[model samples]
Target: MPKDSRQGSTLWSTVLADLRTRLDAGEFTERFPSDRELVAHYGVSRHTVREAVRRLDMIERRPRVGGLVRTPPTVLRRLLDTLTALGVQTSRTTTTGEHHSVEIAGRLDRAPRTLLTVHTAVLRADGGPLICLQICSAASDSVPSELADMLLDGSDRESGQVSVVYEGTVPAAPDPEVCEALGIPTGSVTFCIEARLDLADGAPILQRAYVRPDRYPCILQFSAP
Candidate 1:
């Protein structure tokens, strides 16, 4: 005779263990399997499946780097989550669109003539400038106006999947606008993170970010499976 089934929690734990093992083997690359699929495969209840997924999320916690908050580098994060984690208030400083530069266009896999929206905002700690963020996204006729509005509001909703992220320091030259917004001297260095999010077609959807290093130093940390 076959062995009896385990309890709900016990079965969930067993399934979670199996999933983790598979994850370590790089099974779920693009996206995780659906909860219903997991439930069917593991012979567990829907509640059990959800609890297992929740545990995976809590296995890792975000870290604070200076004034910036970043989640484990292994997972992708939305801009709002990162800002909210700082536990500080913020306000939008500027939101404008301009013709894409050759370099930026190349990075975004878009045409130089394409109009790209530049969204800039300042994060405040105790009513002072902590960091300034500038995000650039595609503003083509193909993209819906409502979705474009979200990007202008500094959101990456329905943007795409993050394919690559690069971090470096840019030696700033005399820029009146940056100097004014960040309250820093000309030629001051700025920390920048450029992420390339790609659609299923493998075309870039968005790229580029800028932050004040002095006020919002950031670090990337993660663990091996």
Candidate 2:
């Protein structure tokens, strides 16, 4: 092969590899770049850009319907269930500690002056950090044995509890502590889930979790009426 042609081939292969990495990292979730945009961004010829994207099965190109569209990443129907469906093995580390936060106490329906036991857990999948959870409940002695056990192991054992979950996204930059725990760099985005579990005959348990969507995308399914 000619020297310039060989260099072009190598460059396109490099672009293809980077594109795959960005796709897996959820960078193109909202939009897939145009051939012109990719050419400009990667400083390659339009033919080179097309050659790189042509091999990506996740991108669909249809005539007149739309330009290149990215297929959504596979979603985990529920994270609380065993991660076997996603072929991921998960492990967790829990630390028992005390927290005195008015906000947490209010959520748990405890007195502002009461001391709370916080169970901080960092869940990993296949040795990679997945999520970090902080569960707050009444102090050690007052907490039910079952609830405490569940908290310690990071299990979802709300047999007779009313659970309300609030989810949103937050930038990881401001939360250096959480970024370190989740093994994600600062300036990355994370999904945050806050759950209030109200037991039948006990104070509510407040759980806050930060999840890395790029690593583990999750979706909730609802049936039509």
Candidate 3:
């Protein structure tokens, strides 16, 4: 029997777990299983299946209708979930860059225990012409010495190592300095994550990522506990 068969909350959690299991098992084959197939396999309504799928997307990205799904990383980075916690109560992320933009300017109240104050940031992501960040210290800071070297040498970095930020209000466009930092052309677009990592000794690690926004949307569903 499954771990939790009880209805409502328990059932929802079970479904979400099972959905992730199937995806990891290659049930989707770089594509989504048909709605009918999913319904039959999960023995649930279309709505329930949709909710389960949505959660998997938030935890791990999936393929678009015709795009290929990227392979999940072998080692799940612990940092991703911790960073996402700041966004749990988010409302109305009204722009192309919603999922990836966080306002580093105002993360003072509930800053993560691992981070010190994020003093300031200019560049926030990789894949741009010049990925630049001048992070200050926290006693336990673990940002590799090599990373600083990598950025200064003009190497293009992925968005994960950094985060993106936006004011609570939407803007006409993402920060151009961020685009330039990420090595993306001024006009080219991508999905990004703006965040503040409480690093070293309560030091704030900030990012301003520019990414293809349509590719990512943090979704959720509810069920029994």
Candidate 4:
């Protein structure tokens, strides 16, 4: 395909076919130029750029759009940390890979209690394979429900950040039931996930999640400040 491809075909069928050929022929691999770059190089408009890479084409990957537009690792880390922003949903699935449950843990009025916890199977949006098993625990007496049950059916009304405050909380070890539920070894390092606990409490409360970092990662996105 010529850089300034003004073939003027209204129906991008031919153009798309050509673009796909270019892509398959190693024309747009490892990097996809921006609309401006494409225009400067190919004499196409921003509209053509959108038409080429619109959502309908299933081209959602960032590198497909911003080939060399690399983000600082720190910024990417911080963005990944915020689960909602990344479209990371919590749900459960049977061993047969059937969709089972979807729920959220809540908190109650200001009270120091291990309120809500959950065990969920994480899946990528493309739904190709199971990503990981996410076992989350909240210590705030905010949401009063079994963590597992919450995974089945629960509501999350508050928008807050889950953080880690202190280490070596009382009991100091993973709860036996939680360990069983999450299938983690008894001596595994359980992450102390301290969330904002934004419910009835004005200040942050202790929401501890005993996680196996090996299976699950603490995802956060960070960019150059």
Best by lDDT: 2
Q: Could you tell which candidate, 2 or 4, scores higher by lDDT?
A: 2
Q: What does candidate 1's lDDT look like per residue over 1-225, in tens digits?
A: 111166766766777788678766767554566666666677677687677766675233222211111223412234335666866565544445555666666677677776776555555554666455555666653433233234434344434423344433343442466666777777777655455555444545443344565655566454453
Cα lDDT of model 4 by residue, 22-131, tens digit: 76575654576666765565556667656765522424346435553122122212323454466665444522111122223333232343344444442332233222
lDDT of 4 at 218: 51
Candidate 2 overall lDDT versus native: 0.65
List candidate 2 stretches off by more than 4 Å: 1-77, 144-175, 186-188, 217-225
- The sequence of per-residue lDDT tens digits that candidate 3 reaches over residues 53-85 is 666642443333322334332111222332245
**Candidate number achieving the greatest TM-score relative to the actual structure:** 2
| Evaluation by lDDT, superior candidate among 3 and 4 | 4
List, residue by residue over 1-225, the lDDT tens digit for candidate 2: 112255778877888999898876768655677877776788778788778888887687654332554332212214645476567787777677786888778776678877898777788888998877776787843544344346424343334333333333333432687788898787677776666665555457776777787775556454443
- Between prediction 1 and prediction 2, the one with superior TM-score is 2
Clashes of each: 0, 0, 42, 26
lDDT (Cα atoms) of all candidates against the true structure: 0.53, 0.65, 0.40, 0.40
